[model samples]
Target chain A: MIRSLHIAAKDLKAEFRTKQMLNSMVIFSLLVIVIFSVSFGDLLGDSETVSQLAPGVLWIAFTFAGMLGLSRSFASELENGCLEGLKLCPVDRSAIYTGKAISNVVIMFLVELITIPLFAVMFNYNIQGLLGLVVVIVLGTIGFISVGTLLSALTVNTGTRELLLPILLLPIIIPVIIPAVLATGKILVNGDISDISGELRLLLVYDIIFFVIAQLVFEYAIGD
Target chain B: MSTNSQKINILSILTAIVMFIAAYMIFFYLPQMRDTSGQLLDSSFKIFYFHLPIAITSYLAFFVVFVASILYLKKGTHNWDVLARSAAEVGSIFALLVLVTGSIWAKATWGWYWVWEPRLTTSLALFLVYLAYLMMRQAIEEPEKRARLSAVFGIVGFASVPLSFLSIRMWRSAHPLMFGPSAQGSSGGLEGTSLQFTLIVNFIAFFLLFATILAYKVKNENLQEEINAKKQALP
Candidate 1:
């Protein structure tokens, strides 16, 4: 656990010094939002369509941007032999997996922090139930990062790392994305929290299931 | 060239003979199914003879992949990796046939080409997951790493299948089962089997055919591996 924490902190410190991933991801996040707004600009007059579209757009932006940050984290490691150094450490490989996943979840949270409010401000949509929305985002990000991090490792050694990430990820993680989108949309539409409790449970279940499976098998993905 | 290959050839020939018999039974002996009032279902329903059987065979093929993947991870065996690869490719083909035939049946019956029905969506997602496994395999160059990584991916992809189905059913909020609640444990169940005897015979035939194809592919992969190893040795 200490070694895992060390790995996580190492990445976090590096991220702080360079800020390369965060800067690029923030820019990427902004562009995704701008693109979404421009595409939906014509429907700005229709509040109903905007409300319905807002949640989906927010998630699509968050999900794809998270994909970029996750891949870049590993891309750096793969290029600089940091991954090799980490693997040479005398620790359980699952620790490295957990550490990477933790840093990824934190990075995604930071990205979400920037983008979620930006999405609302840019689109002129009101987000209700801030607490509920935050909960939904946290759970949803966990589910996405858990699977995405594992898959990033799996694909890091491959030839087409950039393209293969989304192809392998989107389908397997649909269970997570679908419920998260629905729940977030519900909150955005002024629906009661009671309305999306089922969606919340689905997200929780998905996170736990994938988290366990990914942890148990993480060694297989990156191990020698 | 060897006794094992000779035996596989014989088995494939017998599989062909059995498939022909199944076809004969489907087309010649079995009559078209009729609904009430003496009205016959569309002749397109005859695709059921191949479609349903092949669908089940595809599921069976994926199950083989799941097993072969687990075995590969546990034993680190090249044979199991070959089996898993062959099963995935063959399974994807069968899954594609399912989608095509199911689409045609829908067009004949419902007058539309497609619907986002839960079963259809799950099947489509399942096919994509299968293809993703193959793509992942192609992206890796080293043999051992590719085997290990692909085995993990194979397990993860199959695990996601049931979750994907559940998620779709949950999101759609439908009856959850094709056969409704009342249909459970009843003789007159929902439309699981349209033409029961014909379906059974075809299933048997298709399963044997799946086995033959799997053996043929695995045998050829082994041959290919040997050829590659020998070629590398020549240098």
Candidate 2:
């Protein structure tokens, strides 16, 4: 586990130094939110409309932007031959998956941090129940990035990285998206936690299930 | 060569006959759906027996593919890979049936051919995922690598089934399950011995059809292998 964390920290430092993945994602997310605001300008002027759309905007922005990071993350490892080097190290392949999943989640979580507030401001929504909203975002991001990391490894060796990720990832992550969106929508509308707990629990269950599956399957994806 | 060709021809003829009978039963024997007002609805209710069976079969095919994928990775056998690939191919066709019959059902019941309802949305997502897996295979030139990557995807792709199933439950505030509480277990539309009889026949038909397709695909793969081996030996 500690070894995995070391690998994860190494990835984090490498990601920060290159900044290619992070920069592209951040810019892409911001652009999506900006475009959303412009297209739905009249809709955004209404508090009700903005509140309802906030969760969707945040998810779409985060989900699509995160795809940019996922497709390149492991494919680049294959491109640069870093994957073999990492495999040669004395760590379990599942640990490598764990590390990568952690880094991806961190990057996605940070991106969500920026995108969510921007969405709130652009749409003139307060994001009342901010604490509960953040919990939903964190859980949802966990579910998204867990599945994303596993899929990135699978698609890394495919011919077209760009086309494969969304087609492959979107279908698999629907469970994550539904509950995340529902929970966030509820929080946005100021619904009681009692009303939204079912959705939240579903998201948590999805996150745990995918997290475990990704760990077990990571070895096959990375191995020849 | 003549004998092998003759066998395949016979298989094709048998499949054709079975399918013809299935279609005849679907169009003739199925009862029309009556709304709450006791008015007999249009002939479109005929699409239900066809649509629901195809949908159920497609879901079953995906699950089979998922299990086969896991076995392929564990055993590293080409046979399991063949099974997985064949299941995926037939599953895609069934998915097509699901989409078409679903559209027809929607037109009959909801007055719109496509509503993006929970079940429809999930099935659409399943169709797209299956297509993506096939496309991924086509995109790869290396056979072994293609099989490995696709198997991994096949395993992961199924994870979305439940997600799509639950999405409707989460998002729709007003619309409840048509039949019951369980997301996919609702028997609202089908009642009495009719439901049981239809379900059993559909399962048998789908299974036989599935086996026929699987055999054909495996034979094709074997032929391709033989041709490849012959060409390599000549050189």
Give the candidate number with the greatest TM-score: 2
What ranges in model 1 sit over 4 Å off?
Answer: B24-40, B167-188, B191-194
Q: In candidate 2, residue B174 scores what lDDT?
A: 25
| DockQ of each candidate relative to the true complex | 0.64, 0.64
TM-score of each: 0.89, 0.90
Worst 10 residues of 2 chain A by lDDT: A190-199
- How do the residues B1-235 of candidate 2 rate in per-residue lDDT, one tens digit apiece? 7787678778777767766767766676566667668888787666666666677778888998999999998999988887888889989999999898778777766778877466576778889889988888888788788888888888888877766566666555322344556544533454667645655676666666766776788778778878988998994
DockQ of 1: 0.64
Shift in Å, residue A208, candidate 2: 2.0
User: Can you write out model 2's per-residue Cα lDDT over A112-175, one digit (the tens) per residue?
Assistant: 7777778777878766677788788888889889889998888777678778788888877776
- lDDT value, candidate 2, whole model: 0.79
